[model samples]
Target: MEKVHFTEEKATMLATLYGRALDSREADPVLGDHAADEAVRQIDYDFAKLGITRDSAVSVVLRAKPIDEWAADYLRQHPDALVLHLGCGMDTRFQRLAPPETVHWYDVDYPEVVELREKLYAPAPNHTNIGTSVTDFGWLDQVPSDRPALIVAEGLTMYLTPEDGTELIRRLVAKFPSGELICDVFSKLGIKAQKLNTPVRRAKATLRWGIDDPHELERYGLDLMSSLDASHWSTPDVMARLRPFTRFQLRMLKYFPALARMANIVRYRF
Candidate 1:
């Protein structure tokens, strides 16, 4: 028998919300700031039908939190920076970043996800949506080079080989003279284990990346900023409610960066 997991774009959103719901539960005020006022609860309901559990949901939600938190803080450092979200899927990061009218925002992804996003979210004057694969270099020419930029790639990396991931970013950083980029990278272990463990997912889109050291990307042209732990972002109280095994894993991640490498973020300079 095979267990069910979310489809690609849907899984990405579920993952982003999972961390967010946990943050929301922990009373992180920033959590509220990142949520789309017009879309929060409705997005929650849409995910409910997927049958993913609360804990599973929280894990995914945290994916955006670290970077979302970073984006919020990033604004304080550079208010007018442009933000480019790769494989933007259906997630609402522009609303999360709440960029000023002065900030330029771009949401990009496959034509399919962008199509679905249009049904739910319409771009404001400052926000733009482009339907394109990250592998394509066309979108880079569209964003202005005159201002600093921050880029995020959520659940899209796991579908690409490490080589392609590095090249895509190499070009992005090269295309934009100054910018910070953050993304979640899944390892070969997680993909192999998840697919073998859940047969239903293996038949769908594949999980392609599992590189542990996102810093390795420097050779490809991106400057390393930070490596974030997927589990460490959780507060103590949230950790307590997790299953004993999850609690143990959290503890391990806190003390051990290598373990954290299993699921982590690599921030880089352009």
Candidate 2:
């Protein structure tokens, strides 16, 4: 393995991968991603440079879990759906979910990241890797539009300008006859606070978009189905199981409306 020279935006994928790998190693993991753990072992990068800690990794996994759950549910209903994983990075969601053979899965990302993924992971019969930016609509043409679809954009929206993100969603909704999208959004405060986010700063990436209300997406002609505050410390069951100090810190965020609104997981249907 050699040092990967990914651009700042592409490098952010390493942070998420590191987070998933960290969570996978926990005794009682929040979102165990053994594939991520394996990928981490295979990649030759300085994990320390990402500044990922146990606590931060937990946050990352927690935010991802809800989206995974939603996708799982969608797949159950439409096992043959097309799954478009935008900004796929080195994520192993397809391996984790293992949808039916009838399903077609496409992992879309920058060419370099896709190239790295091809080297790191084995190919699946129904899985296609699209080497292109998610903001580029041309990649969407490579996917079939005549089936139910599940589009996932994890840890990705904030990197796109609001107009670009909205346009992407609008295009997807209009392209497919019926489909669902699961993605995360940052609040105005969260975007501002990214300046202090260790992994983000280390990656030299800046947050570009935020939304106060999930309904704001309706402006793009999407039907906002639901949204959940996905802060790692916000879930009652997860919080109750944490150490007292951790619980206390999370409780403070939960009780404070402004802070609690920082991050959210939203689902939209077309």
Candidate 3:
């Protein structure tokens, strides 16, 4: 297969997947994503340029674990629900979750990303691939509104402007009668810190939006269920197996509330 050429923002998606794949290769893996590992092997790219290290791999995979858990729970509750994975990238979440056949899965992203995804993934009978930016509300019409929906936006909100991100949430809440949204957001401080984030800087991607308070989503008519500091709540079990110095640094970060607030995993219901 020919190598995929993605833009800066789109390239970051591949970087995260590679990180997860690297983590999965460890003796005791946190997010055991064998599919990601396979994709990394099949795809031709220079991973070293992405600045992904063993330490960063743990952090990236840990961020994705919460979304997987939340989506899995929602699918169990609403077996026949519609799952909309915004900014899906090349993530194999649907494969990992393995929701019931009754669930309809839609992976939405930029055309280039979706095209590459088609090469790497085969959708189930109930699944569809949508090539469009999340900001475009046109694609929403294609999705059925009768069934409850579960929307997941991982590592996506930061790239959008506040206006665009909030509008996307508002549209989703308004479209689905009873549904849940699980997404991660950066704080204002976190947006500033992105400049120093090696992976993000390496990808030449800019972080444009952030939310310091979970209640901020309420402004857009979304019912904020919970917003958790990822550094504290989403630490993967495998983290304990890391070097003592690494574990100590992560533990220290947990005690610093200001620093901890940098990234959060939030859940909202409509």
Which candidate has the highest TM-score of all?
3
- Candidate 3 to truth, TM: 0.96
The RMSD of every model to the true structure, in order and in angstroms, is: 4.7, 1.7, 1.4
Per-model TM-score versus the true fold? 0.80, 0.95, 0.96
What does candidate 1's lDDT look like per residue over 1-270, in tens digits?
112244654455543543454345545333553443344454534544444454554565556668787777776787888888887765777876678888878898877657656766766998888878777777677778888888888777887777788788777777765888888876556666655422215224577778766766688777787887665677776666678876786677767665566677667776
lDDT assessment of candidate 1: 0.67
Q: Give the per-residue lDDT digits (tens) of candidate 2, residues 17-126.
A: 99999889888787779999999998888987888877677678888888889999999999889999999999999998989999999999999999999999999999
TM-score, prediction 2: 0.95
> CA shift at 75, candidate 2, in angstroms?
0.5
**Global lDDT scores for all candidate models:** 0.67, 0.87, 0.87
Q: Candidate 3, residues 72-190: lDDT per residue as tens digits?
A: 98999999899999999999999999988999999999988888888888767988999999998899999998999999999999999999998898888888888998999989999
* Worst ten in a row by lDDT for model 1: 195-204
- Sort by lDDT, top down from the best: 3, 2, 1
